[model samples]
Target chain A: MSLAEVAKNPAGTGQKLKLQHLGMVYGQDAESVPVLEDINLDVSDGEFVCIVGPSGCGKSTLLNVMAGFLPATAGTVTIDGEVVTGPDPRRILVFQERGVFPWLTVEGNIGFGLSKLTREERRQRIAHYVQAVRLQGFEHVYPSDLSGGMKQRLQVARALAVNPDILYLDEPFGALDFVTRVIMRGELHRIWQTERRTILFVTHDIDEAVQLADRVVVLSSRPARIQDILTIDIPHPRNISSPRYLQLRDDFFFWRNPVAGRDSSGPSSQQQPCWRYGISPFSGRPPRSFRRRLA
Target chain B: MKLPARFRPVLFIVLLLVGWQVAIDRHPAQILPGPIAVASGIVDLLRHGILFKYIVASLFRVTWGFSLAALLGIPLGLMLGWFQRGEMAFYPLIQIFRPISPLAWIPIAILWFGVGDSAAIFLIFVGCFFPMLLIAMTAVRNIPSIYINAGRNFGLSSSEFVTRVLYPAVIPQLLVGLRITLGIAWLVVVAAEMISVNSGLGFLIVDARNAGNRYDLVVAGMVIIGIIGLLLDLAMRSLENVKSFHWSSSEE
Candidate 1:
């Protein structure tokens, strides 16, 4: 989704986040390890994109590069025609709940980046976000006092309170239990629909990717490269048990070439529980998607 | 007999006094005064206004010296922990001086300040300074990296980061350092007063023995010192128990 295409296409005029030939390498000389190679991605404004891969697949490294926390070894990440050299207040990265300041209360965390605002303005903004995140009564409570779900919500409120144009979340809900995680996904989707800020969310869960993303980007193993990008055209208020949703979910398992010679149709004994649970537990082989919704 | 917690200490003291009286019966009065004699000595000093004056004098020196040390040491430590170059330049110097007892500084303090309250206060300051510096430095260094990153991400400038994040983060550990340094400062001041000053608990003990072998007055001076040190420690303990500091206490 290039800026030119977005501009020519009257339906979308919002700013596009562009990444060209992004490459990142760690260490030096022989010890130098490549984390990302020949990566190119374009995210249109107001879109929710999820990058999904196995645990050690450098998905987070890619996010850090895009967030301007780590520099790309080779490439330029530009937004609205300006190259990103460092982290800007316009694009905030909401780290795992660990990033929330334990020393601060919910109100304090929300108001942390609002130093530019007047006292009255900061107060109103903080109160609005605290209530928006369903933390109205926990204003004076510290992160340590909050539960996992509440803390993640507090982090979201803190990030959203800053009013950034783009949000980069790194496995934000990975620490929550299954039920809480499912609930949080709905809350995030609701918040995203209401806020309409461009979000690039990183997660390893296939179900999570399918549920929340407008486009789910699949990446190959170490020194990750985009293997496929699948567009989820399903409307919101999505039903997980609905045939279309289950088809898309199961499609990921088929797309992910599970153990080379095995038949893709029947669920093997090892995969039966995962299929029952609706979350593939195994790190199936990297997916090969025939449907490249966006190139 | 059963006693309330508050009365238990009083009962224990009464027993201690009775034991002291019996122990002193085997010795001459000049060698070890009985508890009754020490009580009379305390009353005489109080009536003459000598005990209160000496206490006030000692407290004045301690306050000045401890305040001076705290004012200087904490900032120096904060900088040392924050900047690698500062640690490189000053940490070795701190390590070298920390082990040398403040008693060793007494001769130099007298030579520099010339044998009065200045000499005693200098000794107290030296005793208090190193602990404050080291503890504060460690406290600053121990603040989790996540806090620092969060602070910066919020667009806090370098100075704001130090003042807003670093200071509050280091406070709980720093408070413990303050209480310990004060105890050392009080201990050092007394030793300093015994050698160079004219009026303090230390001076009272020396003067009682020198003027007329008043063992009872010397014993009374010792008792006062113990009680005062205990009180100061209790005050600091209360500060550590405050709600904001409770989080750090759990780590210990």
Candidate 2:
């Protein structure tokens, strides 16, 4: 919906975030390179939305614009019917790199944004989040001392402590190992279940998008526009081994790589190196032929 | 089978002393004092109390000059680094002035302060200020944008942003700069005292040379300066052990 439509029917529409006709271009005139174009999206209160695209497809740029770190060349991002002119504490962005402040201890990082709160309130909130993220013992330890997963959890705890209305996660687990990434995703889902904050996550991993998001918004290669939006009809605590899950996962794969879906020459045609096609083949169940080879 | 790390330095120092004594044994004591002569010369100065007085005088100049430079340069550099326009305007000017030796400023310092502690202190300040400023500026520039963005997203006001983000972020690098700049200040104070002051270690060396050729006292002064410089560096290095600064280094 457009900003005017949202504004006119503010009480009826429960959109926590509305992006209308968003466009972004770097530089000016002859040097200008377009990144995102003619994009529109609406996210309801407490909705979990994920944006998935190929690498270097302006996914980060889109998140930056939404977080108000960068100005869109031609759009208005309205949250709760108010225009987003700059960053606000109510909307926090968690970076892919361990964005936890290395200088501050775990408790210190969680308490960083709570400077305006009274001492007792701040202490209670920090303690609550410390336990929430399962970092009970390491409160006084710095980020450098923590393992990669712990550091990412600390970043999440720091964001959650502020009680923000929305959390923008820009490929937050992209730096983690395979096992750690899966563990972090489960941890994030648990947090989301308890916290109920609107989360707009961006990632290149399609499996991550399907596993976490209520609705997955797929974007095409740059001058990024919304190619399709798929709503996962499955319930929470989704069974990865379920036939429905496999169907949806394969559908997303084929949507991403149409040629591979069409050319059904007994897995040989699809045996090309994944990186050349920008496909992540290791995510869920590998192909039957690959599984047989491995066995 | 191997010597402990702690004893290696002591062994090296003993070898150095032995090498020095052997090199100087053939020369007349008047031409070059041996280690024993230099040690005796130090004891003699201490007995007369001039050694303590001269050391204090040199340290006093360095303390005043280096403190003044740090007090003024750090804030100015932070401001310039945060505001790109200010950096663009002033950085080239700083680059032009930074290359000229602090010794070259000796004449101007003397002309302004007129051959005393003030002149020496001014030269030391000149030597230390540019380095501190450059270090602070580069430190601010090197801060990851992620930190700054996170700080702003928390709705920090301008002053809060500086105090909560900029200051803490630059501290690790600033400590390194302060250590190096203080070393420069120490070096500059001695040179400044040689030409413009009457009561510092540099004066003691020059006076010993000119009056009755006390080569023992000259070597004694040199040894004292080296020892004091090492102590100063050790003191500066201890700042890195503070808990807040530990994140910059790999070790816990």
All candidates' TM-scores?
Answer: 0.82, 0.91
lDDT score for candidate 1 against the true structure: 0.82
Q: Residue A99: error of model 1 in Å?
A: 3.2
lDDT (10s digit) by residue, model 2, range A89-115: 999999998587888999999999999
Per-residue lDDT of A203 in model 2: 87
**TM-score of the A-chain for all models:** 0.84, 0.85
lDDT per residue for candidate 1 within A43-155, as digits (tens), equals: 88878889987677799999888878788999989988889887777788887757777667888889989988999999999999887888889999877788999989998
* Stretches > 4 Å off in candidate 2: A1-13, A256-276, A282-295, B1-3, B27-31
Q: Compared with the true structure, what per-residue lDDT tens digits does model 2 show for residues B112-212? A: 99989999989989999999999999999989999999998889999999888898889999999999998999888878888997888999999898898
| Candidate 1 clash pair list | none
